[model samples]
Target: MLDPILLWSGLVNGLLQGAIYALVALGLTLIYGVLHIINFAHGSLLMLAMYGVFLLFSQFGIDPYAALPIMVVGMFVLGYGLQRGLISRASHGRDENILLVTLGISIVIENLALFFFQGDTRTIDVPYAFDSLEVFGVFIAIPRLIAFAAALLIAGLLWLMIQRSDVGRAIRAVAKEKQGARLVGINVEHIYAVSYGVGIACLGAAACLLMPTYLVYPTVGHAFVLIAFTVVVLGGMGSFPGALLGGLLIGLCESFGGLFLGESFGQIGIFLVFIVVLLFRPSGLLGSRV
Candidate 1:
């Protein structure tokens, strides 16, 4: 049996990790839901966002958090243009084509970063990076706690946007039937572009939030993309609520798995859960049948 204290530590740590996974998966899920695109480039975009923050802070002495709004806006525009110019051409239900395009984009971004940054890993060392609180005789990492809170808060806001907002309704409409949406006075193209942009913006947000803890590098995005996809698939493609649950679940698994099985095996265990979910749940905790 696990010790009570270790269990508590794992629980909080799992929640924190889940929060990070949720934010990362949110962008991928959003694009998947609204645009029916897998967005393999999402992780690459996240890396770019981190680099963006890094450049701003390192060169201009701006705070990493302070550059967030700009990065979000810039990423949105970047996503919009990329989708409009490349992804839009793939059209609906073209899963293979969309995947190829996004994958290509990821490769391009990764290579560009490699060419520029030369594979050096870097992290944004914010004030109190190592700070944490003690609870029940357990040490909780402050940055992770903050990241977890931010992730949950944003996830909640995303849920509201999808379930309650007008734009959210339009996105759903477009997702269900693009032609019908066009007939109903919705500009499918614009919505598609904007949704893709929003997806990138989510990546930007995650990057900014993660700066204090994780390192920034050309291939950094690759490290976490698998976990992000696992969360998206396990939670339900295009389901923000599912993403949150999936993220937290995976985080907890990683925490406990690391404690018992070791960090390397922890990730493998998470992948196995993903496989099990696919075999049994298929649509994930919240995804719908297409």
Candidate 2:
């Protein structure tokens, strides 16, 4: 039998990590929802943001948190341009064409990072990196907690934008009925660009929050992109709240599976749950049926 304390600790840690994963998953789902494209390069965009934070910290003495606003603006511009210059051209193409284009973009970005930053791993160390808080016999890493708070704040803001703002309504209108939106004078192309920009901005936020806890490398995005895809699929594609719930579920599975079944089985446990969900609830836990 597992020790109760150990189990509780794993659960707490899992929740914290899940918050970070939610950020990434939300970004991917947003892009998919609006653009109907899988964005194979989404993780590579995150890799770029991670490098941006690292450079700001190491070369300019800017803290990762302080650099977040700049990162968001810069990533938004890049994402907007990519949509306008490249992705928009393929928007009308078949799904395979869009997939190929995005895959190409991902490869280019990865190689470029490799050429400039090399394959060496990099990390940012802040004063709070090693700090922790204990509550009810459970220890929580302070950095993780901060990241969790930031994730929830961003998620809440996104929810508000989607629910209350005119731009958000426009985005939803385009996603739901592109032809009707265009007929009603909505610029579908521009909305697509804005949606992509927002998606990448989410990645930027995730990058800043994650730099304190993880190492950055050229290939790091590949693993994260896979995990993000798993989260999106598990939560149901295009479901915002579903992404959060799926992330927490995956995080808990990884944590508890590692504790009981061993570290190697952690990923397997997540996949097992994913498969079960697919078999029984194809639309995801909170997702609406298509």
TM-score versus the correct structure, for each prediction:
0.94, 0.97
Each prediction's number of clashing residue pairs? 1, 0
Candidate 1: pairs in clash: 122-216
Per-residue error (Å), model 1, residue 249: 0.6
Q: In candidate 1, what are the lDDT values of residues 1-290, reduced to their tens digit?
A: 87999989988888888888888888889898887768889889999999998888888877867787888899999999999888768645477888898999999999999999999998666787899899999998787777778778877887888789888889889988988999989998888888898888888878878887788888888877888988999999888889889999999888888888987787777877888888988899888776
| CA error at residue 290 for candidate 2, angstroms | 1.5
- Listed per candidate, the RMSD to the true structure in angstroms reads 1.7, 1.1
* Candidate 2 lDDT over residue span 1-290, tens digit each: 77889989989988888888889999899899888889999989999999999999999989988988998889989998888789778656567887888888899999999999999999987888989999889888888898999998998899899879988999999989999999989998899899889999999999999999889999888878888899999999999999989988888988888887888877888899999998999988777899
Q: Which segments of model 2 are wrong by more than 4 Å?
A: 90-92
Best by lDDT: 2
Which residues of candidate 1, in runs, are more than 4 Å off? 90-93
lDDT score at residue 203, model 2, on the 0-100 scale: 91
Native-vs-model 2 lDDT? Answer: 0.89
Instruction: Tell me how many residue pairs clash in candidate 2.
Output: 0
